[model samples]
Target chain A: MNLYYRGYLLGDVRRFPHWSEPSDAAGAEDAALADETIVYLRDDFSVVRSPVGADQGVLWDAMTPQWREFCDTVLRFRPPRESADGPA
Target chain B: MDRPDLGEQERGQAVGLPYIVQGGGENLADRLAEDRAAIRDRLRTDGAVLLRGFDVGGTDGFAEAVRALSGELLPYEERSSPRETIKGRVYSSTEYPPHEEIFFHNENSYQQSWPMTLYFHCVQPPAAHGATPLVDTRRVLAAIDPAVVQEFSRRRWMVVRNFHPDFGLPWQQVFGVADRAEVLKLCGDRDIDAEWRSPDQLRTTSIRDAVHVHPDTGEPVWFNHIAVFHMSTLSADLRDGLRELFPEPDLPANSYYGDGGVIPDDVLAHVRDCYRSAATRFDYRRDDVLVIDNMLTAHGREPFSPPRRVAVAMAEPTDAGARP
Candidate 1:
């Protein structure tokens, strides 16, 4: 898929919610937003804020709240899938 | 400046080989709990991701980070290197002699099932060198001669391992079971061909794809132990010594064509060059945790002076047969 983390500028998530550039090239931060917001990634790439009090994001795994927002937001990143009869 | 530490790397060199996630001294386990999926996606895209300046308490804390990011840690199976267990799922990174450099290899590439992710935690930076050099398998594949790649793809490659009494690990240790029947059952299950040369000596052979498709990225990658498992890859001194000590069929470990034909020495040399052309490295600092998407990147050790300590964990099982 086109969605990949080529490179990104790191910042305090508090100060930089839209921390990473939307494309592969590294660029200046889009310092326009200041809340727990899902920003731009290619259409396939998405970010969700970890659910507040009760609205658990569409996932069942335990995670730090911030990550709860985007756990299943990307490629089928479930735990390594195994069958009732596991890997040979 | 030539040392290639995180600051020097971020200053605009190494092509930002793998994206860096600066934790700003935050507890890494905590950060992992928050955005493991996003972090993992970043890793899958970059082939590797460096988690620098984070607080990974110790072996215990490192396990916490692994569980947070990977959900479960895969136990060390079909063992090769001598790794000492420190805590649950956290083991000392390949206790090869401190002065010997390990050639580049994807972990468990020869096996039927392998971990999709590997996390290396640098507990203490080595005194001199000891950087874990990394090679993008996609880049390695791109650099190889297409003919060489195609020939290997068609023929596949075979690994012949000899567990001897004098040289190499005993089969009991490698198999982790003392019972011969259990070992045979495991071999049959894993599709490995096993033979008993002598009562205490065992020889096993397995054939696997030299090129494999990345599970997430879907790109065909040059992924195999063809070179590393070949006899010619060793230094002339060691190669000659081993040859003199054992018959060709009884060497500690060696590789051949899937049909068991000899792979020319020249082909092995060309393969090594492609890996070299695509390799990159960064010096480790204490608390630098490197998370690798195992299929996308091949990693190796650079020989270093003593006092270097790195912890490792593997997770996310991906079956080899699942790929087309």
Candidate 2:
């Protein structure tokens, strides 16, 4: 189960055995960034990266404490819009 | 067996897979307060996210969840698929037969203005194979051959639509206007080229970019309904039957180059291949919610078995105009 505090997903709290991390993939850097790792979060509370130069970062476990804290502090949850249709 | 508090951690299997957050019987109000910013950032970066096991059980719960995300609600105007408005900002999902597979396309991408965000609430998941498959548009752009992408970008694309009361959706239903003057005014506002074949029949064409860049991230994404709208999507038998009824130009819907040239079959085939290879899918559970940035991702439906009902809500309308 993913635990989120104030819309920020808290990491290092769980493990996902079924997911296979992609290998040595590199997307063209976002036009706004230069020489920075393109980091994204995976479903299992793990952080992932596209390879940088020759460095293929470790999978699911390389998320640093600082990154985790940043996500925890900055992420916000958005709920569904209110509707009269009521719950299903 | 594991305790429920441990959380079900099901990871996706691709580079652009959606991140899933499972609920632990907590009220959605509490969940929204915990991470609205994280959810937004992930959506901007990841394209799609799923929330399962939450209290979003019915139309009210679904609407409440959507409201918590953003109060901005977009109108479902200029629709292509058949859907009925259920309540305030909530509508039934596409009403296609269960046996048919809906091809991948961005919601309302054919229109000049479309909802920036989309939410899907699953009331009852099918007993078998009712998965709403998603593909990250960024990944799709990356996967397609650069040469083909460049050619499409240069040529742009034009969608041709003919609304006939005898077949498909009539102009009245499509534009939601009964009077011709109102329909003409609406079309004029959006730069749609409209012509009247008869008092009730109408044909329209709109040219749009085959690719679009996200406003927030500046990431280029594949954003068009070219493959789905093209004649190639129809089986030969269906195509022949349709041709017997109307000329190629008078088909319910079709696509071509903005300059009125033919788009080759091989090009569309290449695009379909990319979508198939890049798609990531997961089964929908009752009360699950899937949120997506409309321009950042594309969505489609797979053939399902029984008892599937999904409701949709859209918000944050953005006008792409003639460009991204």
Candidate 3:
């Protein structure tokens, strides 16, 4: 899923299994990102980005905390729309 | 999912793929009336918006929500795939078999007039893999080889369709009329050329410019049914059977150059590839209402297991007035 603020791509939280502590986003098991400033949300619920021009950064995990937070916060503010025509 | 219990909420707009907005409950209709302007702005910027987890009252509320955002709803004219009407202006999504993928195209892009906006409400999501795939037409235009785009722009595009008593949708069902003279009049008014090869067989042809300028945004969009209706886009088995049974012009459906010449197979493939490359797809959840700016985005269905129900409605009739 992509996260957008004012129609522009903000960093998004996505899930893919990783083999080890992420050296870089490219070296992570997920499909590589090209030269993006890779940010990692470690299991401790803290956010960290790889050093500038650094080759590697270790990440314990990016977990349910960020995902749940984004969803709850956005929905609380945004207040989604609705449709009828429920199941027959 | 654990979210902190806050005393109150901050209000603003943010977008996701399809730009999800949530939290309308029993007062969905009123909330819709209040937020309609915001929703319209989001749709224009995002191309699509998915409204999730709301009561929406019922079918009446659905129509109310649509009316709040887009003034009037439209009937599905110039029909292609089979669909059943659900309520006054609501319809079941195209009634193709579960296993067939409906390729990406803007709704009614082949017609002289089309809906500027589309609304889809998921009643029941499929057992598996029944996503509505989307492609931004602007991205499709950017990805195509300029040479192919130039050719299509210069020549425009043509769609030829054959209707027979025993095969596909007959003239009556396709035209929503039984009178021959009425059909001819409809064709003439719509700029479609109609010919009768036999008492029961009819062929109609339409030439349309392949590119369109977005009415509000003023951006050129690669919009049409060119790749979608081209013969080469069909599955090989179906293609072989149809080709063996009928000549090109007599096939159930096909697309060509504006002057009635064949579009190259490779060119069609490239067009399809461009659409696929820019495509984004998502699974449906019940009560998820997806609103789309039709001209800016192309949508299609994925083959599914079974029991998928999505209700659709079109609004804001827009005529692409300049015919080729």
Candidate 4:
């Protein structure tokens, strides 16, 4: 299943592919992106969305180019399926 | 290396670590100054060294024992929980309501700096049931599911805290400064992201490694407060009450993955289970001292009846990334 990250910016949804977890340059974005609310999504249609970090909008730019593009595209934003466990 | 007369060891079968009782007439307080290195060696090797019959007299004596073990006690700075500083670097341990159980955690693991060692002295045992349970973090790492451990390592963790006077300790009390500018400076120095969530409220988030190798022992350990700080850990009633009482952004404290995603509840449940299965506990008698290597061990409190008093002191501050 493909992994994607969904971030909330000013009530708008920014969807992108989930990249490798931050260690150095690739993970932590710049300070300016601290306002975005990040959440992890999966193609398996799981209803639960795991929270990444809040107020870390600065790190959005640190994502890879491909993931950044995915975040910019809103049409591809697929919501998780409804399940018994409900959204997390 | 001088040693105290020891009594029968207990709990050797249940967990790998055993509790050593001191023979009568021997006081660790008098002996620790001369034998600090030996005791420190034992702490590093065993993860926890429980001393009963040490005759650590009172708060003053406990502070002395701490000083003997690790020179120059560090002030409890950048605090999250409420605790009273009794005397020069000695403080009451997380002075929470006696009915609540304080979950196991490495001291200051959420901060950019933490003490390498911790000392807890039992000034007075609880009236009914009070024991400081201990768990080896290495065992916590091993007990968790491999996938869960892998996920934690990859994603890391970030603790988001909203400090306000309405609930919990305010930022002014936590940072030991009343001025907003000073608090901002302290946050800046510690690499914490601080913001004025509102006119009177402050929000801070700090990222930390979920798993880290012990600085002295070079052994991997689960060393973050994700389980303890997560909102899911609270009871359903308490969580609901809190959500109703405060706005979402102003909730007292909670945690998330380093990348700003939610940590699954099931994962945290598994983690709590591992901690429970591995925890070791011994009755705390008066005049007892427990010294633990903070990175190698995690500690928590059990719900007790009343009249329980334990003093804590920390030393040997190790800055983040300083561990080789």
Best by TM-score: 3
**Candidate 1 residue A87 C-alpha distance from true site, Å:** 32
Candidate 2 Cα deviation (angstroms), residue B202: 0.5
What lDDT tens digits, residue by residue, belong to model 3 across residues B76-193? 8879888898999899999987876788899999898999999988888887767787767776786678898889888889999999778787789888899887898999999899
Model 1 per-residue lDDT tens digits across residues A4-85: 2111111212232323433422225654433322221111223322211133132112244444344233211222111222
Q: How much does each candidate deviate at the interface, measured as C-alpha RMSD after superposition?
A: 17.2, 15.0, 12.7, 25.6
DockQ category of candidate 4: incorrect
Q: Write the per-residue lDDT of candidate 1 for residues B260-286, one digit (tens) a residue.
A: 999999998878766754455566788
TM-score of chain A of each: 0.20, 0.26, 0.23, 0.22
Highest DockQ: give the candidate number.
3
Instruction: Please give the TM-score that candidate 3 achieves against the real structure.
Output: 0.76
DockQ of 4: 0.01
Q: Give the TM-score of candidate 4.
A: 0.73
Docking quality level of the chain pair in candidate 1: incorrect
User: For candidate 4, lDDT tens digit of each residue in B1-324?
Assistant: 000011111211113232353535455666777566766776776687767655676777777777777878999988878898888889998888776677788999999989998988888887765677777777677667889878867887899999876778878888888898888888999999998867788899898888987777677778989888888887677779889988766678888889888888988877876775445555677776888888888888777778998889999998777432
Docking quality tier of model 2: incorrect
After the best TM-score superposition of candidate 2, give how far the Cα of residue B23 lies from its true spot, in angstroms.
1.1
How much lDDT does candidate 4 score? 0.67
Kindly report which residue stretches of model 2 are placed more than 4 angstroms away from their true locations once superposed. Answer: A1-88, B1-16, B321-324
lDDT of 4 by residue, A1-64 (tens): 2122221221122223453333342234643222122222223322112222223223233435
TM-scores, chain B, all models: 0.93, 0.92, 0.92, 0.92
